[model samples]
Target: MSTAFCFGIRFPMFICMSSFAIIPTSIVVERAIALWKRNKYEHYGCRLGFAISIICIVVSLIMSAWSMGKMNLSDLTVYCSATTNETADRITIICFTYCGIDVITLSGMAWLRTSNVAAMKGKYSDLRSSYQLRENASVIRVLLPLVVFDGLSHLVFSLGGGVFLLFRVHFSYVAYRTI
Candidate 1:
């Protein structure tokens, strides 16, 4: 149960970091590019992305530290299962909640990126830069795999998580704990 609780909090962090880390990183790169090129940068999309990501992080931290913070590692023994129906339900729900947020944020970032691209195309229509077109194409190509893999990974996660939620096996036992 303790193990489940810990993972219930941490697994979402893993999914968010692994699956959607690129969005933040790309946003950072966008800003850097603007700085490097000395262009007047519109940070609206990046700002919105950062705001949403921060909100997600805060929620994750709160959920991770919520009930499990008071419990000490010394109190949990490997011999005992440490879960109740309420705990199990909360953990399951938290897991799904985090996963859902991850999916939503990923789509949100995609939507923002599309809008940014459209805006850029409109803004730069006059001075058509082949280099920029090539760069955009390359970014889209690279992002294609990221989006595909993200979707596939989330699908697998959802199915496996749904199974765990269905079986109520989150209370198996606390084999180990980490800080």
Candidate 2:
């Protein structure tokens, strides 16, 4: 029952965070392909950063699943309940690590996007005074917000995950004591 409730909370969060991670990845890939067609090798770093972010997102999801499994195991649950402080500390540490990785990846993507925007602005300045600059400006605007939102979401997730892990540790401890 406790396991079920733990999963109930994590499942929705996983879906939400995954969606946030995946959509920007798609945009990054699309823009990279477009820039590549234009012979802009400059955006390669941004592409690479987004690719890494995608990988980190996948790995984090896997870790979350594994942690859920550990929670479901009867022996581990019992142990966790008995050693609440220890369990909480360990869980908090793991969650903090995961969240830190997520934040770093998101920040990388954001920095890459910011650089891309700066480059585009410089490259398209003369073109900017023309109608063609519309597309260029639009891309800059789009990438800017995506990057910002992605980073912010990662930060929020990190904080939420840390808090949730702490709560789980306490809950496990209480359950163990009562049962």
Candidate 3:
């Protein structure tokens, strides 16, 4: 049950954070693709991107609620933990899934950032166009690194939990710091 509590928190969090990364990164990706394809009628990408983001958000929320339901004890301590075979498997799954999403989303964001920043270095027709491009580029430059850093820390926490589960290691500080 304690093991359940540990994963109950982590899986939901991974789902939520991964969704956050995927949604915006996906929008930028879609826009980049539209520009690459020279498609003038690309407003549809906004709608499609929003639709996918909504679906991902809703699904993540529901899953989070479902996992919370598994935590039956009202007075359960967040610090409580356990190591067992089941937990090892759960940790492995969480780590792999989290890393997979991190790679896909962060890589897409990096690509989008590179393409837009590259375009910003080229000629823009007007002052307003240049200003907006530079602003967008700046935002991406600031945000993507933060996202990558946070995601990498999450990966470390998941791996730490996995090691604890499999080897009875007491690296619970990873969870404490991360959570």
Candidate 4:
């Protein structure tokens, strides 16, 4: 395939996949902050979350564009697999970095929750505060599993890419060539 054709197919896919990969980390951090600043978050959480999502999208766009630009079209054979080993390595590093950030955000959220619970046990105990805590807990309960799943998927993908790189295993579209 021509380089432009390959890029046309890969560019949007990269942007979408990268955006999906990044938005989760943004959400985790936003939730952590919301948990930390309870009352203030309640007032502006939606706007804050939207802003964070936009930032994630913009970051994803930039990263995808840069990576796509770095892709080696000369490597293209019968199919649209044009990325060089260096580009693959960079993508794997990015995936691992995102996974690390997710882990750290989860840890921070846990710490914040514990501190909030301890504080609630003291003089600040109130029905509204308790209700907000429960609501936050419920939201976390729902989001936690999804985030964990996303992280694990990323980890597996990164490991697979690492293994492929280690072995120098490059798969081509032989079936397409035959066709």
Candidate No. with top lDDT = 4
lDDT of 2 by residue, 1-179 (tens): 36455456665575455445455655555544444343443436576667766775776576545444444433333222311333445445655664665565566555555655565555443432333234534675667676667657766776776786666635654563453
Which pairs clash in model 3?
none
- Name the TM-score of candidate 1: 0.49
Q: Which sequence of candidate numbers ranks them by lDDT, best first?
A: 4, 3, 2, 1
Error of 2 at 21 (Å): 4.9
On the 0 to 100 scale, the lDDT of residue 114 in model 2 is 62
Query: After best superposition, candidate 2 residue 126: deviation in angstroms?
Result: 16
Model 4 lDDT vs. the true structure?
0.65
Candidate 1, residue 140: CA error in Å?
4.8
- Per-candidate TM vs. native? 0.49, 0.47, 0.53, 0.75
Measured by TM-score, the strongest candidate is 4
Instruction: Please identify model 3 stretches exceeding 4 Å from their true place.
Output: 1-49, 58-88, 124-132, 166-179
RMSD of each: 7.3, 7.2, 6.3, 4.1
Regarding lDDT, does 1 or 4 come out ahead?
A: 4
The RMSD (Cα, Å) of candidate 3 is 6.3
Clash tally, candidates in order: 0, 0, 0, 0
User: How would you encode candidate 4's per-residue C-alpha lDDT over 71-175 as one tens digit per residue?
Assistant: 765554455652554466666566565556656655655665576566556554555566666666777778777777776676577556555544454455353
